[model samples]
Target chain A: MYLRGYVSSREFFEYNPPQKIQNLAIRDYCSSNKFNYLLSATEYSMKNSYLILDEFLKFRDGSDGLAFYSIFQLPLNFTLRQNIFDKILKKRKQLHFSLENLALKNKNDINLIHNLFFIKQSYQKCLSLTDIKQNLKL
Target chain B: MLNSTVLSKNFLSDGYLKIRPKNQKYLFEIQKIITNKISKTKLSKKNQISFLNNFHKFQNPSNLNDTRLKIYNYINSKSIFSKMYYEIVKEYLDILVGNELVMQNKINLSIQLPNDKSSILPMHSDTWSGDSPFEIVVWIPLVNCFKTKSMFILNPKESKHFYINYKKNSKKHDSKSLFNLYKSKFKWIDIKFGEVLIFNQCLPHGNVENITSETRWSLNCRFKSLFSPYGTKKIGEFFKPINIKPASVIGFNYNDPLAE
Candidate 1:
């Protein structure tokens, strides 16, 4: 299958790996899975920027899928991420996350990805309240 | 007093600093907390140094990990311990790193028993194992550590050469043999109880078997600028914001007016 790589210039997952590093990881992932690799389109390093990704979705080429370096590289806004997923499903194109080694081929896969985002959001919420020391005298 | 510009330049080149803390009370408190928890019998201030130095006698050498984990968990559970840890090195970190910083969630405790082969840290850089190159390690000792009781680090100049040519070096030698080859170049840090050592984690550093009579007790934790580039060890998991400036706080919470 032919897969175009998607990488982000914006820092996510608390750290941003270099675009070169991200691209390399995607290339290796495609090679291991025996998929045809296409040059990556990097999202701009600005808040809520998914312009490149939106453009990638509009392409009507024979590419079978879009591979992301990580699922966290997707837009932080749930609606934006859902819209991307919806676009992928509408196009009948597969979505792959290299770091997570996950695939979104159907509604079930989309649900799994949604669950992961929920889990991460829940974790971040719990962490914000964990610093009990803030109330301590010391 | 040495200016920050000189200190930063020296730190850039040397990659490490051994200096005394501005206040000894916090350091004493930290030592007291660990000692009180570990020692079955209460120790007076006079005996605390001896107690820590000869800890192997009181502690079961075979069950070292159990004692280590207990103290590690105990100290980390107390927010004051971490607060004091940061306070001890706050000045240096502010100058070398920045005022706005993120600290490692859990500080690491090292208990090296005399000649214990199991606990030795092999020669390596934290950056090689997914730690951010921007992070710096603040290492503090509980007793006078010298010779084999302390850790060794390669200077940045030599480390640069070593890392650049690591591909050829790895094929020729393993970690042990690589250590032996560069053995003479390694600086065995001889640090005292009241002093704190801050070093660049990108430099190759580790400890050998503690051949000294005294057991070595040291604590190390990492700190980096809040906005610095990170490796695989991401924030909220490996690190948490210790201090944030007002502008940054406003910036983080700021909603762009132009956004729909």
Candidate 2:
């Protein structure tokens, strides 16, 4: 239920998925992406994370992720996704993070462990192109 | 004196301005006149808000239009009404539009009741329907307006982008769909009784049904420079020169005595 799901399918985009879908997507994305680490870090960290994630979900190119970007590109075709991807990538590189140290400090946090599992599963699903390609036709 | 340069810049950037009126009494008097005209019995100033809010109870859709016209004509007939209207926003109008201006001969009153579908104004630009882009509308509310009771206008920058790509965006969508397309971009104006709004009528602006439990009463009149080029709403016919300067009067009266 990442933000990509909203723009992933033409039906969801046209009919507008219910708030339930939007909420689920946001929670799922936040839980999976270790968003809590950034949220608990500092206000600036939270804002930076939000900016990066929003840009990635909204403007990432099909070449990097899935082919759904090319199909759903019809409605918002004017946006140059590749250019946005490059800009976001440049910004992402500038952003420094010490995941190993942060993980050790927050090792006892149950929520972090749960979120990492969610991330692993969602990432695997994303890597499987057949599942998404089939779902797009529906 | 207000900074004309800053005010002009703000108007040009935002496409609208909400400023406190020069005289609050004028607005109260105008509201009183409207309330008296519409109410079957006399209503005190204290009951003005309730009377306006529950206006739908006074009349149904069948007689709404006739009642509206009656009130419109009566208000325009009062000599103090137009004068008061001008006084409310004359300072801003002088800076944004011009001192030598043509005002709409009749002021327009809009009444939107809660959950009423009959009075909704969908998203549209006045210029799209032959109104002059040179014209600016002076809008004043009789009651506090918020959320659905208030109107929405697309910001200048976003509106420009929408217009530039209109053909591509509109090819697959109708007006309603187009409204949904740029729904997030529209700014809902929250204004109170003592304030006046002078807006660029050329920008896309409109209101949905009054979902709130109140009737919305607002008056609007268009003003433009007297010498500015006219759209379908022409000079002398649709608009009359309200503030003619002395030099313009001399130029208007001057005639060349030739062979005749």
**Index of the highest-lDDT prediction:** 1
Candidate 2 chain A least-lDDT 10 residues: A95-104
Pairs that collide in candidate 2 are: A1-A25
Residue-wise lDDT of candidate 2 within B115-197, one digit each (tens)?
Answer: 98989999999989888788999999999999999999998999999899898988989999999999999999999988888
Count of clashing residue pairs in every prediction? 0, 1
Give Cα distance to truth, residue B88, candidate 2, Å: 1.4
Q: What is each candidate's DockQ, to 2 decimals?
A: 0.03, 0.01
Error of 1 at A41 (Å): 35
| Model 1's DockQ score | 0.03
Clashing pairs for model 1 are none
Docking class of 2: incorrect
- The number of residue pairs in model 1 that clash at the backbone is 0
Per-model lDDT? 0.84, 0.66
